[model samples]
Target: MGAGHGHRLHYHGHSRLHRAPAHLKLVALVGFMLVVVATPRELYPVFGGYALLLVAVIASTGVPFGYIGKRMVVEVPFVLFAVLMPFVATGPRTEVLGLSLSEPGLLAAWGLLAKATIGVAASLTLAATTEPLDLLRGLQRLRVPDLIVQIMAFMVRYLDVVTAEMGRMLTGMRSRGCDPRSPRHWPLLARSVGALFIRSYERGERVHLAMLSRGYDGTFRL
Candidate 1:
């Protein structure tokens, strides 16, 4: 009913950050995430510092706040699960706000939330600012096996095609009064899943045949 989301990454004005080599940027991003993920959960100050650091980087990129906020929605499930820990976790039970809260558990929950938020923010920033081609080039430079890089490149390239095909198949079923949401549709759901598998297999075979006709080999030469 409205404009769809953009999967392709875009570049913006020439900035110092944009001028940096992809490999170096990727390494720094990875390291930052690891630090946030590994830090002790009870260390709120450390987490706050990490969050501020990420905010600084995000500000440096000049990306819109709305974009980062929208992407952070991806962390909701993790945050919810972390929220549940305080109630179920075994530890010194303390009453807070007229509810039983595990002291250690509260710390654990906050830790997970902080880490997840920081991690998502970092990933979103990297993804929003860098082009996929540059990301692949970075991977290649980092000694990621050539074959793996090629597979990733192809997957990213064809992901839209595959998703569209699957969506069409789902739509056809829906049009025929097949309600996937209903519990009684389990059998139909299973069949549809099986059909999807067959379709994917056939698609792969046809693609292989086409590649063979073009004198292709197992190795994907860049």
Candidate 2:
């Protein structure tokens, strides 16, 4: 639609990775992730191989390390969950550094962390090289259902709009002396979230009606 509308994650580049067809990149990502997921956790050396492969891809793409690192913060929550697995999992115990831990949990945690990190890194690399609209086009070309593709497209297109709306709502709250960090303002913050959801839902309904009026026919013209 717009020049920069669907290029938020795309880095301007003339590298071979950037020039590769979007559908091919999508297939490569899926195949690589599938292999990573299928590998056994106990195969530590294999995991190392996956890491090295991703490193080579990153090096080839010419995406800055700092940009990838910053985007990777989104995976921190999953990492934290994996970190707790060793402490909470019940299984055979092992001693390490003077502390007893579940052996299976340790292996599981390592697998989770390794697979997750590699997957996110690969995804980030793909997004950096391909525009958002190109991703949708790739999915369509790959025979994904039209309805699912359109849903994903709309979600990506309006994410910025929803985020900006939430920002403005928070600004309004702040101007009225509401401090979200204070416990007393927790309810206000919760209400704001609910209000934002309702507004977004109503907006979606309006957009749907407008689309129907224009003969959208439940499919995007690519």
Candidate 3:
């Protein structure tokens, strides 16, 4: 990846966490997430401990809480699924707020929410402290497969390019009087998505050919 390709998730910092070796941080992050996942759902206190640990990590990074909070919106779909679990799951029912909810489902939902939240927060914290290139380097150092590392490297490098292309496509559609909110515009919107995919695929192919010309031999060099 080029030095110019800085990810939005990376917060510029010189703190200890930021300076920590990328592979070590990667190992720590995976271990922390694993511990969170392995803890029994009934062990609520353990979950609290995990939360506190994450808070400490976040505090050390000096990244803004607002930045993390905004990114947490990515977990909203999981939150919604957790919320519906109690209502839809079949099991022993109990009354809460004048509605019957499955007892097992409620516990399951709580566990799911807690685990997912912590996992995402940990990931966000890692991203905030580590640059995209450094992350790829870390994975490479950790003996991750070269092909997978190359894929991730390209993803990090071209994500912005692809996103900008999509934005331009959308703008062009709007300029052509396309109103995506209107039912009549659904077909056009779908076609736009298809076109975007095709364009992205072609662009990837071109990039691959260019890489090959430059002696990129199926492996990314840090």
Predictions ranked by lDDT, top down? 3, 2, 1
Candidate 1 worst ten-residue window by lDDT: 1-10
- Tell me the TM-score of model 2: 0.90
lDDT of 2: 0.89
Instruction: Report the number of the highest-lDDT candidate.
Output: 3
TM-score of 3: 0.90
Candidate 1, residues 9-99, lDDT tens digits: the string is: 4436355666678898899999988777788887778878887888888788887777788767889999889989999999899998899
Pitting candidate 1 against candidate 2, the one with the higher lDDT is 2
lDDT (Cα, tens digit) per residue for candidate 2, span 1-222: 233444667787888999999999999999999999999888899999989988888888888988888999989999999989988999999998998899889989999999999999999999999988888999999999998998998999888888889888988878987758888888988999999999999999999999999998866776
**Alpha-carbon local distance difference test for all models:** 0.80, 0.89, 0.90
Candidate with the larger lDDT of 1 and 3 = 3
Checking candidate 1 for backbone clashes, the offending pairs are none
